[model samples]
Target: MSDDLEILLTNDDGIRSTGIRALYDALSEHANVTVVAPASDRSACGRSISHAVDVHEHDLGYAVEGTPADCVVAGLAELGPFPDLVVAGCNEGANLGEYVLGRSGTISAAVEAAFFDVPAIATSLYVPADDETPYYEFDVTTDDFAEAARVTTFLAEHALDAGVFDHAAYLNVNVPLPDGDPAPIEITRPSKRYEMDAERNGDAVHLTDRVWESMDPESLPDPEGTDRRAVVEGRISVSPLTAPHATNHHEILEELAAAYRSQ
Candidate 1:
């Protein structure tokens, strides 16, 4: 990478979110940080990108009228000073588990950057998942993001020099809401447990997961070194990830195809 690293900063929480601003303040200290994000909250938008988008220059940076993925695309393709690294989020909520990764707009931005061959990091804050303090009910102010900002800045400053991205395309980082100066960082993998629950109403089906209501470290089923386990135990979680392309090496599929051709 270059000595003067160019960092592309984005988030699913939109351009004006405290998460993004906190990230900018921290990252700008070490790199040429450019903020390109949705104009409004586009949480859980995943990697969906529109064919055409409208971008407006704002005081903070460029606001794109699109999803998190769209912001990455526009930034890498059209925005100047092509980034050496792409950092997404400081998102309002935790994105843990293999299943949740695909649906998270925060992680999606990093995935998009990986396809562009740029190393990326997706960061999120883990609000206590409880009934009264529901994940969606918590408020994340700029002050609450100090710990995340610090870690993100630290990684951005040193990861490349450390060759952390040599084999990984991107990293997914989730920080628990600071208890007291935050906790230690742990290398983890996405938890495999699936927690989506659904109930049928008279005419509409309501899908929900009561998992958040019982997120205490002692109550969770997450194993010792998983992302969910780490965050619930008050540790920051970092999962190295890759954006995989399909391969035609399945023998079973090949046999099935041969049978169909014979028929």
Candidate 2:
């Protein structure tokens, strides 16, 4: 990292999202920040990309008429002045567990950056979902993201010097709302839980996820060391992650290959 680092900032949420605005304000203080993000909300888009994306300059940065992954790719390849670091999100919802990471546009942007050999951070807020209060009901104001912005700023300032990215490609950060001052930060791994429920309503098939039920502070069964548990306990969860690839060697596959050669 240089004394004056070029930082590329993006998010699944639109350019107008409070989370991104908060991030831009905080990060600009420390680095030469450039924002290239989606023109509209493109959550849960994963690593899907568009080779030809329309880009327009805005007051904050360039807005792409595409997904978060598209923004990262376009920003790196054509936007010029390659970034020293890429920071995605302050996403509207928490991207926890290994399951959501594959589907989240926020996490996918970071993954795309990792493929480019540039370190990145994906940050999101964990708003507890409830029956009375819907998941999207939380007010994602700029003030609500202050704690997340602070943590991101700190990491951008010191993570490389601290050699944090040596072992991991990027970080998946989930922050609980700040109760009073800033919340404590915790290093965690994604929780292991697969809860996919589906129901039929009239002629339509409705998918229901009860995962949030377990994320409640009182009822959370997530272990103390997991990301979900940390957020439920009012702590910011930072899960060091790598891009998707097969690392484990399989003896069964090798045996099959040997049998094919014998044939």
Candidate 3:
């Protein structure tokens, strides 16, 4: 970690997303920030990268015709100087539960950066639960993201010095929308509640996934230590995660190996 640090900023929600813009403004105040992000919304794209991407310069930064992973790869490998940290999102929607982590483009960007040995942070804001709300309905203006941006910038400024990434490649942060008062910050693990349903329509089937719809504000089953619980309780959730998959040391694999040796 040098005295002069360079940060690569990217997002799943394109360069012009209000979340990214708010983050860029906040980070620019503390570090040398470079924004290289998807030109269009790439939410839930996971770690998929484009084979060939077309990039163009926007007033805000470099806009790439690709996924969030492509932006990080191009930014670190070709577009700019190697960064001390990679910050993704302030995503419009919350990416909480364990099932959603692997599907979130914001988290995938951080995971991709971790493979390159750069510490990263993926952030999102959880929209409050309301039945009247339309699907993907959240007013994430630049002002609404100030608190999240502040926290992210503060972490970026000191995370390296504090050795936060020594044991983890990236951190996933989810901030609840500000409601006049500052929310408490909590370190949490991803929750394991999944809500997916499919319905039949004539010959074709229509699939509907409504995880948020099932979230009961009065009584969520998740314990206090989970990301879903924290967010539901109006707290900022931070989950430190590693990039590599965990290994299983089951007897089945050992037996298979032994059988192969006997053959």
Candidate 4:
């Protein structure tokens, strides 16, 4: 399995990010891996792409001065060997809910790979806020991603032969921070719980995602089998997802189109 596999790796975090490096080290042991990632942190940068950008050589791989999506495009089309799979991240924070999918650079990179007809996995670390230290302020080193790297490497090695990609284009994986033991892996769907709040004060509108504030394991609003629920409860959440928006036939739209021709 190690000799035949080639994995194109990229992340929303910059090329030098410890999370990506951990992934590079772990996955490399099982497959030929290349890292073509943004030169700087391009977090939350959806599917935005760069038409023209600079690329530089790095010890890991090529560092692109562009977004995560751009890194995928460049990796697949240029710098890397056509890969067996595209693996994005080991990101610093979780990309959990359905609402965050469109905004998360980690998910966006996986979606970009899906568009190319390649199986992909986007991995993120769900860091819970401790009583004394805030999650946002917590500093995670490369060593912290060992569990995530181990699990991701296992999936990368076996998911293809197990028919995982035949069911969905990509997998969105969120793992809790390594605590007592490696977390149990759970198959889940992206949680639909949304708590976006906007307040106007003077000329400024403060936007907040209250979901982050409500991640108590004992009192979480999310039900079982949801990505948010699993991660908060110390489980690895792997959500099988498809790229591109799903659409359905609409009779109302068809009637409107027919009536517009007469006008």
Instruction: Report RMSD for candidate 3.
Output: 1.8
TM-score of 4: 0.95
Write one digit per residue (lDDT tens) for candidate 4, span 1-263.
56679999999989999899999999988789999999999999999988899999999999999999999999999887989999999899898898999999999999999999999999998888755766657889877898889889989988999999999999999998888687899999999989999999999999978888889999999999999999999999999999777898799999999999989
Query: For model 4, what is the error of residue 65's alpha carbon versus the real structure, in angstroms, after optimal superposition?
Result: 0.6
RMSD of 1: 1.8
Over the stretch 1-263, how does candidate 2's per-residue lDDT look in tens digits?
Answer: 35498999999988989999999999998799999999999998899988688999999889999999999999998894699899998898898887898889999999999999999999998877767886688766788888999999999999988999998899999999888878989999999887979998999999876787666688788888999999989999999988766588899999999999999
lDDT of each: 0.88, 0.90, 0.88, 0.92
- Rate residue 95 of model 3 by lDDT: 88
lDDT: the better of candidates 3 and 4: 4
Q: With candidate 4 superimposed using the best TM-score fit, by how many Å does residue 95's alpha carbon deviate from the native?
A: 0.6
C-alpha-based local distance difference test score of model 3: 0.88
Q: Model 2: what TM-score?
A: 0.95
Q: Which stretches of candidate 1 lie over 4 Å from their true place?
A: 1-3, 245-248
TM agreement with the true structure for every prediction: 0.95, 0.95, 0.94, 0.95
Off by over 4 Å in 3: 1-3, 260-263
lDDT of 1 by residue, 120-213 (tens): 9999998875555667677778888988998898888888889899978899999988777657999999998886888999998999865566
